[model samples]
Target: MCARIIRSLLVVCASLAVAANASAGQVQVAVAANFTAPMQAIASEFEKDTGHSVQASYGATGQFYAQISNGAPFEVFLSADDSTPAKLEKEGQSVEGSRFTYAIGKLVLWSPKEGVVDDKGAVLEKGDFKHLSIANPKAAPYGLAATQTLDKLGLSDTLKGKIVEGQNITQALQFVSTGNAELGLVALSQVYKDGQITAGSVWVVPEAMYQPIRQDALILKKGADNPAAEALVEYLKGPKAAEIIKAYGYTL
Candidate 1:
């Protein structure tokens, strides 16, 4: 009876060891949609440096906030706007003093078809398109920028009912790409990346049109001591990651 018990105990210990080994080398990240492409590039570099695997979930800022609050097991959050992380820190979901601006987002007007969005400011005011797409301003930073740009350019009222709102920037881009909408307001990173332009006419929105979209990162309290989380932040601030982000058309 004693010999049989010892064997069972050894088997249980081996299973636990395997589970620990699998998780010990990985990090969990929640990233905003706007930074998806660049984050993938950064992840490769981070893994190369620290031998740590990274798993990231991407979505709208508000949607991600909901996920984090519901106790989704994420170690870090890279927000498209600084406010979400600030709110998380204040709400005790993330470590205070760990939130910092990591990148600046740029807004753009783009279309997948020719002559859909003239780079000139006239198209918005011209009001010829049947459908214009923007991410939901309530949940997306890029959506907020799109609204602000219209207000600044005195085109909001003229373009109001013509708008089709998407749940997130990714969806917003899809609305235009799928030919459901003629034009859209989307993140610069998605339009011009990998040394190529998406199939579209793009107008890089002027920085002066809205508040600076200062993107921020936070180390969630669940992972304050995670080695993978620490290494990721360091890698993001390094040269290779910065180059990748810049290539995606975001400002440092």
Candidate 2:
């Protein structure tokens, strides 16, 4: 009788998965640049667990913010900073009571090879390198943090001409990885993943060097009942996702 009941439960669960998949609603997500890797993992895992599909667009947090404010139909937002998500909540762009931090990002001075940048966020200060890449400060949280770090060290004025701006942190990292730029300011996660491959040398910048990169996620006003969006967001805060976040060198 017990075995029969277990078989019936499995049948019911399979039927539910099929029904949920058949009726699954589509969700559009706007993710922060720094979160690309982890978000990809989360998206894959969420789909496997819930039998749902989601579409994502990634960009600089500020750029996404501009798009959202301009009527982009994003059903979820993963912000690179706390302020923007909080502001979106205030402006009613997101569902009330559905915002929270998903990760604490780590900024780094990254190069294609080791020894390119010695200790200190001082590599750009010398201005000898051919090119230094950073995300556009006006539209990327990591870029803004890079600028703030340069300013605090009194090097912004000198490095100003050597800088190349990318639309997002991922692009900025690409500039260095492709050797178009000798070095870049980037998020730590891009350099390493648990089971994936990457190449780079990175100095994880200390938190004191800049304000925290508190990445936040939320269900948008249109995504109040989006199971995929909610599941992905909730999954990120759970044990499986937390392990992946840490493995990529984020703090939490």
Give lDDT tens digits, candidate 1, residues 17-48: 78766755788999999898899988987777
* Model 1 lDDT on a 0 to 1 scale: 0.87
lDDT (0 to 1) per candidate: 0.87, 0.83
CA RMSD, predictions in order: 6.3, 3.8
In candidate 2, what residue range of length 10 has the lowest lDDT sum?
A: 195-204
Residue 213, candidate 1: alpha-carbon lDDT: 96
Model 2's lDDT to the true fold?
Answer: 0.83
* Top of the candidates by TM-score: 2
Residue pair clashes in candidate 1: none
Expressed as tens digits, the lDDT of each residue in 110-183 for candidate 2 is: 88886767777566666779888999988888999899878877888888888899989989988987889998
Give the clash count for each candidate: 0, 1
Residue 229 error for model 2, in Å? 2.4
Highest lDDT: which candidate?
1
How displaced is residue 122 in candidate 2, in Å? 4.3
lDDT of 2 at 234: 78
